[model samples]
Target: MTNTMWMRGVEWLAASAADPRACKWEWDHGEGIALLEAGRFWDVLSVPERLGLLTLDLLWRPALPVPGPTLVDLAAGRVGFFLPPDPDGGWVGAGLRYATRGSWVAVPPPYRPARSLEWLVPPDGTGTLHSPGTLEDALRQANGTLAVLAAPPRGPRES
Candidate 1:
């Protein structure tokens, strides 16, 4: 199997942090409807993925330590995970770094667009972000990426 850029970085995380993608995700989770080739995805997950649900649980961190700047599908009844760039250059984290641009990224809960800062409300408020692993996994399970998952979260948090 071919190794994606991450695999090489996985071998040497300290060096990969300088990679530009790390910078992008460090600030923003991601956009929407992104495509993830298998090679890269596996590198981020640290598992062959053929391992199935076991891999899924680890990525979701159901029992493990979770990281920052994650992305997920918030569409009701169809939530899923996606691996954002490690935000740490893949040097010291446990989650995978998925390759994406400005798709598959839903505005986080209570997310407020720069222009709509005054109108922010529940789901529109930009806080309580999710794990990108869940976002990616949900899409793959959905059997399609073109299908954008729910609109971005609007407004502030309930708590």
Candidate 2:
């Protein structure tokens, strides 16, 4: 998907997390999947907004055979997770042998706007699924130096 489209999707996900009626169920990438439904993986969208957010993204690891949307919490400098699973099988991400069922992991930024998934550090594929409280803590500990990176770059000042 295009960058603008992706950003809009993420924004929608974040905004509609609370009201199920707003987040309608639909197929993603032609796969029969619900976009965001309570008790489903997409529930992460409901993550409280108090956590300074950078952007949310959908990770499509071809090796795994399904696509998963990830919430990129830049203020916390980590990729938050609460997904269910891929339709074909487990979820695939950077680094690691197999896929993870569901859990939160640190996605270190490269001190700039993320151009691709390469910018993120893959989850270890094992750990306790992060709670909203845990995510809040993680963001609390993240360095602020890169927080600026999350913002769109400013153009040259007018003369």
Candidate 3:
């Protein structure tokens, strides 16, 4: 993305904070990351890195449109995908963690990478976010794939 595009993305992300100016100041002063509230403009669905990676791969496999912003926390082994706020709290999946209203997420500056927490897919500055239904489908598929891979190999049938 161009510098202007990145700046726009940064602005979009900073707007998530209660005080966008403060958030921007933090980023400008080399704070690297800031905790932003969720469930206002968007919510976050976080999953284990392994599953998240698989889900992301599946999400990109087809000719489907690109997904929204995705943050990967290497130290925590987690990945957070941005989605439009769901007031009904409808999302549910094994090992899934949703950051809805009143929750806080440590977000990095969209213009640059942070230490352990960085964007796997940075925002495009259009307020675009992942479709909840589409993301849920991909998560289910990825979970199944992981389960299959983890299952023990079947031995020869008993004679």
- Candidate 2 is scored at a TM of 0.25
For each candidate in turn, the TM-score is 0.21, 0.25, 0.95
Candidates in descending lDDT order: 3, 2, 1
Residue clash pairs of candidate 3: none
Q: List candidate 2 stretches off by more than 4 Å.
A: 1-34, 39-42, 45-80, 83-128, 143-159
lDDT of each residue in 1-159, candidate 1, tens digit only: 124432332223222233435433532464411133322222232222332233344445466344322223322212222333453334232233343332222232222222211111122112223354564454355333223444465798799
lDDT of 3 by residue, 1-159 (tens): 889878889889998898899998887786788999999989999999999999998888557789889999999999999999988777777778999998999988987767798888899889999988888899989999999999999999999
The local lDDT score (0 to 100) that residue 112 gets in candidate 1 is 25
Give one clash count per candidate, in the order shown: 47, 1, 0
Any runs in candidate 1 off by more than 4 Å, and if so which? 1-56, 59-64, 67-99, 102-104, 110-159
Q: What is the Å distance of residue 130 in model 3 from its true position?
A: 0.3
The positional error of residue 32 in candidate 1, measured at the CA in angstroms, is: 16
> For residue 159, what is the lDDT in candidate 1?
90
Overall lDDT per candidate, in order of appearance: 0.32, 0.34, 0.89
